[model samples]
Target: MSYRAVLRTPHALRTFLAALVGRLSYGVVFVSLTVAITVATGSYAVAGGAIALFGLGGVLVAPLRAGLVDRYGPRRVLPPLAVTYAGLLAGLAATTWRPGTPGWVLIVLAAVAGAAAPPLGPVMRAMWSQLLPDEAGRQRAFALDTVVEELLFVTGPLVAGLCIAAGAPAAGVALAAALVLTGTLAMVSSPVARAWPRVEAGAVVAVRVNRARLEPVLVASGLGLGLGALGLLIVAFATERDQTAAVAWIEAALAAGSAVGGIAYGARTWAASQRTQLALLVVALAGVLAVAGLAPGVAALAAAAALAGLFVAPTLTIAYLLADRSVPAAARTRAGTWVNTAFNAGSSGGSAAVGLLISRAPLPVCFAAAAIPLLLSAVLPALHERVDQQVEADPGAEHDDDRLEHLAGEAAG
Candidate 1:
């Protein structure tokens, strides 16, 4: 779980670089698309709406797409999707270049483009879990991945910013498209990514309706809801303060702080006792809410947002770790999809709710709204542990220990 582990392990290094390339492309596409839309339509609302549509499209498509990944493997789904996503970006750019394009046309294009985007986060996570081959390694890998994601987000927008400054925001989108197409094709071709066989469609079809199989997904849905609220509050604050132009800066600072926190988490050898990580989550959440509520201008908000993000990444990282342990191997990708879908849906809903709040009251009201989820995250760990212990201690839990050992071994490999 230390830098030395990443330093010494060739598999981890290869897997990480591959994952990082895919992620960088994803970030670049988002920034480029948003900036392009804003400039082309001459409306910030249009750009915001396009981004929102993207989120909604992902939520709608991800669960089904995940089922495909589980059935056909990420190898089959990811590469073609990357190529199609690139084409879509190119099409979007073309649409913008034409004069007198209708807003509705842009909207439809955005919606379709959003739906076409790859599920890089889930795919990379699954790869990391497989690459590391043990619980400790998985934990460290997740922490490292979290940090990498933060860094990617920070840099993605900078690239977009530079592209926009160059008088052709399409440059970023074009570059993103190329990166995604190349990276996905190359990564999916790797021996590591192709290790698992595709699940039989019949088996996946039968399991689709099993409610018993969806418990972890449901819980993660709740977590995603809380985060969605946080996203809304941030948007409201950024928009109301006329800091829309600096949105990337704010995001970069927040991500930078989260990366720092995750690096600290990853650098350690022993896992922080679940109890300690939970306590830190609570303290961090409280600090985030307090800072957001203060509304001490952009600088203060930036610092607070970063502080809030510090714990946010670690909390989710732990959740994914628990998920890896809980779900059956055959169901891993599907289960991971559910967790991601829940997060997307929750964030969308949270944003909608806070947008309403912002319409009614001052910006600080958004922060107050963020507090509810932070408080819930603070409490969720204890409840989650108890439920987990109960399941583990059940007398009828046949082969549970052996299964855990096997899973740990898989992670360690």
Candidate 2:
């Protein structure tokens, strides 16, 4: 089915647009907060600390927040979180309006703001799962979602830059607050969000971590690790050649390639299972990334980056699809959140790990090292399938599995 068909699915356009508006705030808040904190405290160190805390708060609390959405439903849960988050952001902006705000205060506020940040992306994906039950339609929806999110991230910084150029960094924060609150309220007002049934608090069972469930999270982390390392690697590559300005063009090429790849991937229905597709895509991505280090010049490196980028969105979209299909409806949001958290955590770890190696190793070696995670993770899908086959081979295994799931659910309740 075409993307147009995906949009034509009842309530799809309304729900997706509302979610996008809220998600755009996520794109805007981090950079705005960093600049605002730095200007207020006059220390990049303080800014860095605040940003770290902000990320820590959001990442650490994400699964829990997603769980709440799963239990209580978005209609009941999202508004309060959005209100608290926006309020914190507004307060943070107010504090940064004047110089000499205590660094500790800024750090504390940012941490709380992040903790209160709504899980709009996961919630939206869950809604998509509900809205589009047909596999082909769902795939298109996810691809469109991923591509648009990529654009938002790219556009968000430019929006912040404009605010910064106007000498009102606080405006960006306030604007982010407005965007999130408005978008969330609008989203919840939609039939899709409102129609989502709240699982009784006692109805939820713990999510089972079978091979099928775990594979997507691992693959997502690997993808994030490679992409994260590539960012710094690109910068380092340009710096060594005394052509730092080329870094932006190279990154742009990567994003452009991803967007095109995502659209094309969604436009066609694949014959392979998501797991098989995921493995092949990761292998292709890893091979390209490894070859990227051998580029003869900036132009060649950009081309390699673009080639590697072709696999990114498709890989992630498949990972998310696998994640959604791995669990019961009540656990779907949490499952997707785990994938998101893994990717973010992997990105942070990749950047840190590569930072230690970049100065000590050749650029080619660093690139190869970065590709290692993707290469290793590419095997997980096959392993997952093997486990599935094993389970299916035992006739009594299905009953036992159901019992275990019931017991786990009771314990969770």
Q: Of the candidates shown, which would achieve the greatest lDDT relative to the real structure?
A: 2
> Worst ten-residue run, lDDT, model 2?
399-408
Worst 10 residues of 1 by lDDT: 206-215
Cα lDDT tens digits for candidate 1, 1-413: 56667535656566567667877976787778787888888888887887778767867887677667766777888877888877887777777653466777777877877788787777777877666777777778878777777678778878888988988887888888777777777678767677855566567533453322343444455456555666666666677688876556666666777788787766666555554475467556655764585766767777877887777677667656656555655556666677667666766676667767777777666667656655554444544444456566886764544544454466458
User: TM-scores across all candidates?
Assistant: 0.81, 0.93
Instruction: In candidate 1, list every pair of residues with a backbone clash.
Output: 132-411, 133-410, 133-411, 133-412, 133-413, 134-411, 134-412, 228-347
Q: By TM-score, how accurate is candidate 1?
A: 0.81
The digit string of per-residue lDDT tens for model 2 on 104-176 reads 9999999999899999998899999999988888899999998998889888888998999999999999999
Whole-model alpha-carbon lDDT for candidate 2: 0.89
RMSD (CA, Å), each prediction? 6.6, 5.1
Which regions of candidate 1 fall more than 4 Å away from where they truly are? 43-49, 197-202, 205-251, 269-283, 295-300, 362-365, 377-380, 387-413
Predicted structure with the largest TM-score when compared to the true one? 2
lDDT, candidate 2, at 169: 95
